[model samples]
Target chain A: MHSIPGRRLIMGLFLIFLLLPIYWLVNMSFKTNAEIVSTMTLWPHTPTLQHYKRIFTDESWYSGYINSLEYVVLNTIISISVALPAAYAFSRYRFLGDKHLFFWLLSNRMAPAAVYALPFFNLYSAIGLFDTPWAVALAHCIFNVPLAVWILEGFVSGVPREIDETAFLDGYSFPRFFIKILVPLIASGIGVAAFFCFMFSWVELLLARTLTSVHAKPIAAIMTRTVSAAGMDWGLLAAAGVLTIIPGALVIWFVRNYIASGFALGRV
Target chain B: MDKTVNQKAWFLVLPVFLVVAFSAVLPLMTVVNYSMQDTFGNNQFFWNGVGWFKELLDPSTDLGGRFLASLGRNLFFSMVILAIEVPLGIVVALSMPRQGWTVAACLVILALPLLIPWNVVGTIWQIFGRPDIGLLGYVLNAIGIDYNYVSNEIDAWVTVIVMDVWHWTSLVALLCYAGLKSIPEAYYQAAQIDGASRWAVFKAIQLPKMNRVLLIAVLLRFMDSFMIYTEPFVVTGGGPGNSTTFVSIELVKIALGQFDLGKAAALSLVYNLIILIVCWIFYTVMTNAGVERKVQAESEPAAKPKSSAALKPATALKPKEGVA
Candidate 1:
């Protein structure tokens, strides 16, 4: 009973520490650049909508966000689609080199993104995919597919073998059976996998920034360029940072109950 | 789970192989090519096998010095990250409420830092830690702590480490929370019946339940932290000197910034091997410690394959642990 108070105190302090920087980001986003630089206040003084306005009105700024979303969504769909069948095979059947194949796929996830930055740029350009969303989407699969399969396989295996056998006995073909029964049964896993894929692709900067120049430039990359071009637009930079967090927040909101389970690899 | 041995299962796995090959294999080959050959401008190259690698691994040369120095920094940083985040994550996971809307709210807020782009994370801390215009900077100044990350090497290192912990500890906490939640209610009841103390209950029940997930949390954190670039790159540009430069940033500087392709390629291969080797060692050690109770069950002949049914809830539950 005495530990309850201590636990609550620890949690409160940690959450406050976690939110302090974010609070500053949000507070600065609403101020004018002059107000932000010239003085420090606990919150925005003489708040203005001008920073958000600039992002929305400028083609470069707005398109940066759109481009990031385009590639992120593309990568998520591709990662999940390929990972599903692979996950099925791993979960329900054994084949030659399956063990080695799984290890190799997972090792790709562990490789540093920076190592691939130069080569991905060269590879994508040679194939005519440079500066395109598909290039980033495909490049991301090197990391995302392994993660998606790892997560999906965990969830799939948690389901008893009886379910798959019973479905087949009921005269269900593999394709129809997989689409109707197996898919719904592991839909939570799919959601979890998609969120992780969206997240890694969304937050990743080294590969995404290196692979695209103009047409597919991400907002994060654009934010970096803003420093040199505009000589530190503090207000606008904070505003862009705020916008970058929205998609992830929205995704997490949609899958709240499943978050812990997903991180657990869906055993529960 | 019972798995049938069907060579045709390769068909299901083929798509993943092709996609991964295109994305992973081709680029890796290019890295290999760059490492073995000397390159000049206008797409010209000459073979110089193992030369870059020799300079990089030997500590006397400038290239070798930077490589060793940054490798030390990277390994040190990974240690610091794991040291702080793992214990902190376990505490946070333990303290989280078992149920209610509060759970959802907490999860969402914890993920916010993780969801933000890595550069934005650096940007936030960059401005946040500025002694003049930033909140953390201004507060520390007001309290009379001479903190300037840009000018002070110690301050720069501190900022990068704190930023990583802030950004990633939630992931560890979330994974541990999942492990904690999956533990059956009976374990707690049995502990109560035996009059076990709080620490005893945790050590005997909760900690073991979390063993598998904790291994995962450790490895993922280690791999990512060793490769950390954007956050520190933005915050200090790896400066106040080379105080915070990691291998990735150094490789980028040589490859992209300085345009020394061969040296960069060599650095990349050696850097990647270090990560993989460390990972393989940790993984081998952990899995050998009886982590895969499920693998033992599955490796038995199919005709008489018998898993521990009562522990079936936890069986083959080690899907991520086949190569753990």
Candidate 2:
């Protein structure tokens, strides 16, 4: 293969550009608030674990992460389960309004979360699911389900149709064929779809913040409220920010091999 | 790849339809209803049909002026983001190492910024660009440049744009990388036999191979940038006197901050309509592109075996035609 000139240098510089801000955040998370405001240092002069300790000890701070995870997991499960059969259907058979239905589903994915925030609050409140994890989970389905279906459909199409025929020839029922035969074949697709569902649900703030006031506030929302209520405790805020990146980092690490194809939604 | 025509497939898709409709259709109805009604503090409402939409489109009204100005800013921002990120991403993808442990390391690093929560991304830049103690800002000021995002409109815009580029360029690069990976080695060998220069090889082979993924990258980036809310909102708070406020921020302000439901609903409908139209265009174009590629592939039976052999791995893992 032909190599581009200055390839290493280009990659190295781009990586640094990406990491520098994160490095700054981590650097500040270790310093005292006074040091953050009063001095400029390349590294922490007196590095402390105080911010992390504060977050670990405080219920309001830590519960924010728990709340975030609760909705994220719920949303992932809901999105993938519903998307699987739909993806299979779209990949395998022609149905009435199929093209229009697929277009409508994709359109929902393009709908801005800001546009849905007020109505979601009102809708969830009316249904008595307000301030609950279920509200955010179900609300996120508006986008994640379509995305999951879009992605999983690509993976499903890669599987030859003969497998479904063979399973049926062996006298397997449709549900049995799906769970016992077909699901295993597209497991990675399910994983990819679930990863996306988790990522979007985890990062989203506008709807999560709007639907839940106190009981189910995500860590992102908590960080915002902390800044306003405590008046720029920069170290604590930085510490919280650092924690939010850890779960996603772990997820990316696990999916590193599939990262490129997954980002393309398996179309590549 | 031929699919059987079976209407019973609707049963399988019914669950997704119901869930999405419950979430999408109901709120949409509520938004339409709110857009036409006048409300008071006591929940008393009057039918003010089309009044809010009239004001929203008229530019002479305060709401109309803010909407149009923010819409213009949003367009400019999306254009700038695409202009910078697309070529930069292609360059990065071309520069990527082919086969090594370093490939995994580089991929992980490239994806890190994407996984960070959007607000946390904002916080990172917010802290990084602070003029007092932040590294970027302090270094700029130390070298005698006047820089502060809080007080300067241009600085604020630059910060938000840079933050977006940092956060999303990896997506484009990764997509391009996948496209490049699917290209067969025989094309490069043929170019070498022809004594093709590096630029010629890229123009003829790599660029055509990358077309589909490039389109996908552009569409995703444009939509995401146009709807961007949390990052810029956190970094600048749409401040320096609303100079950095995009449509999402302005809409949220009207809806959540000021509780002006009628105006907010009207703005939301128009905003969503624009996205839906653009999305439909991209969808049509993409489906047509896919059909053209399918036709070309089917017509060239002589070259099919070699290309299919090279594409076997990618095809087994992910067939490219399901994008429609």
Candidate 3:
């Protein structure tokens, strides 16, 4: 192999390029709003925990966390439950309209969420499901189900047919075989699928912003209103942004080990 | 793998089908309904019968201009994103450590930007690009380049594009990395034995092997860039004389800001059709190529035993034409 210093230099520079914005974000989050706007300080001169304090103590700020958590859980659970069987069917069996159906499902993923946003708002409003957690949870499934199905199908296909046959020979019913044997085998796949579902629903803003007025909105939606009354609370906004990164970061950290071979398994 | 049908299994797929249908089919039906009818503040819809579509497609109207301009921008933006991200992603993936904890750490860091919510990404860039306070902005101004995303069209476009590239480049990288990782070492060994140049090895061996994953990467990037909304919307709000306005932003303005439901629905449907058509074309081409590859791989006589093992593992297991 070539020990190219040139390649190493380029890679190092790329790494720094990738991390600079993040460093800037972290640096700004620690600074006082005055310093943020008034002076060009790369590092905070007078770094304070006041923003962090406000995010924790303030009702409006903390409420965003609660709303986001509530809906993300609901969305993940609903999406995965539906996706598992569909994925299994696609992976294990040759069926009627199988290719067409699989393609159709994937095509849903390509549909811009924007196309349906207005219609969804109207539909949810008409059905009186507007401004609610369930509405966001349900709406998320539009993209998540297709994604979940696609990922899970990949994982399930990798599990050999003999495993199912052995379980059946052991007198396990199809559901029993699937639950007791198949699910355990594809546990990592399910984990990857779950993480994706959580990530997508968690980060989504447009429908989250449009659907709810106040009561049942996610943190991403609440972040929009952080500017009101206090003339753009940059401190609190930065704090909230930092805090929002925690759950996702944690999820990614946990899922990182599984990611490499997970996709290879036809799952992630 | 047997043809023996389990009719009871439909029950399992039923819940998911119903949920997805409710979310997807219902809203779609609603859009269809709205596109064909006009409402005048009483919740009563009158038959419009393609009138809104006619007006939306008419060249004289601002609505038409807004739609066309945004669509053009989106197409261009998607192309720019594809050009930068795909090649860059592939290069990064190629350079990645072939094994161990370093590879894991790199993957995690690459995924960090992807984890952040789109709005926060917008916020991060919005504040980070301020000439008065933002690091990039301040540095650029100090260097005498008067940078301002809020007012400058070029700056806004660059910021939006950069933000997207930063956010999504990892996805392409990760996908390509998967493709590369699946390439058997024997091929590299053979290339080394043959004393092939690095460029030749990559072009002949790596690129050909990565076709399927690359297909996936391109399709995903195209779909994502085409429908991109949140980051640009929050950062630029499609401002500076609508220079940065992409299709989604325009759609939102027409649908929500102007409250033109019928026309918005019509425009939405048109946008959906464009995406659908493009995606269909990509899908068809990729699948056809995949089929060709499978046939070629199977039909070709044993070229070299070394080459056989060196062949990509991904190509080995891909569907034989209709398997997907």
Which model scores highest in DockQ? Answer: 2
Report clash pairs, candidate 2.
none
Which consecutive 10 residues in model 3 chain B have the weakest lDDT in total?
B315-324
lDDT winner between candidates 2 and 3: 2
What is the interface root-mean-square deviation of candidate 1?
1.8
Residue range B27-130, candidate 2, lDDT tens digits: 99999999999898689888999999999999999999999999999999999999999999999999999899999999999999888999999999998999
Ranking by DockQ: 2, 1, 3
What proportion of the real contacts between chains A and B does each prediction keep?
0.77, 0.84, 0.53
Candidate 2 ranges beyond 4 A from true positions: A228-230, B302-324
Per-residue accuracy of model 1 over B1-324 as CA lDDT, tens digit each: 457899998998999999999999998999999899997788999999999999998999999999999999999999999999999999998878666888788888887888899999999999899998898989999999999999999999899999999999999999988888877675565455455556655766678888878988898899999899999999999897899999999999998899899999999998888877876766576547533666754664452447433333332222322221
Cα-lDDT of candidate 3: 0.80
lDDT of 2 by residue, A83-122 (tens): 9999999999998999999999999999999999999999
Worst lDDT run of 10 residues, candidate 1 chain A, spans A1-10
lDDT digits (tens) for residues B1-324 of candidate 3: 443466555666677778877888888998998999998867888999989888888868877877888888999999999999998888777777656887778878888888899999999888788787677888998999989999999999999998888898888878877777766677776566656656656766778767778887888889888999999999998988899889998998878988888888999899888888887887688669756866776765566454565554324322321122
Estimate the TM-score of every prediction: 0.93, 0.96, 0.93
Which ten residues in a row are the worst by lDDT in model 2 chain A? A224-233
Q: What is the C-alpha RMSD of each candidate to the true structure, in Å?
A: 5.5, 4.8, 4.8
Ranking by lDDT: 2, 1, 3
Each model's lDDT comes to 0.87, 0.91, 0.80
Q: Which stretches of candidate 3 lie over 4 Å from their true place?
A: A1-5, A261-268, B1-9, B289-308, B311-324
What DockQ does model 3 achieve? 0.58
Residue A112, candidate 2: Cα error in Å is: 0.6
Which stretches in model 1 have alpha-carbon errors above 4 Å?
A: A1-5, A228-230, B282-291, B295-324
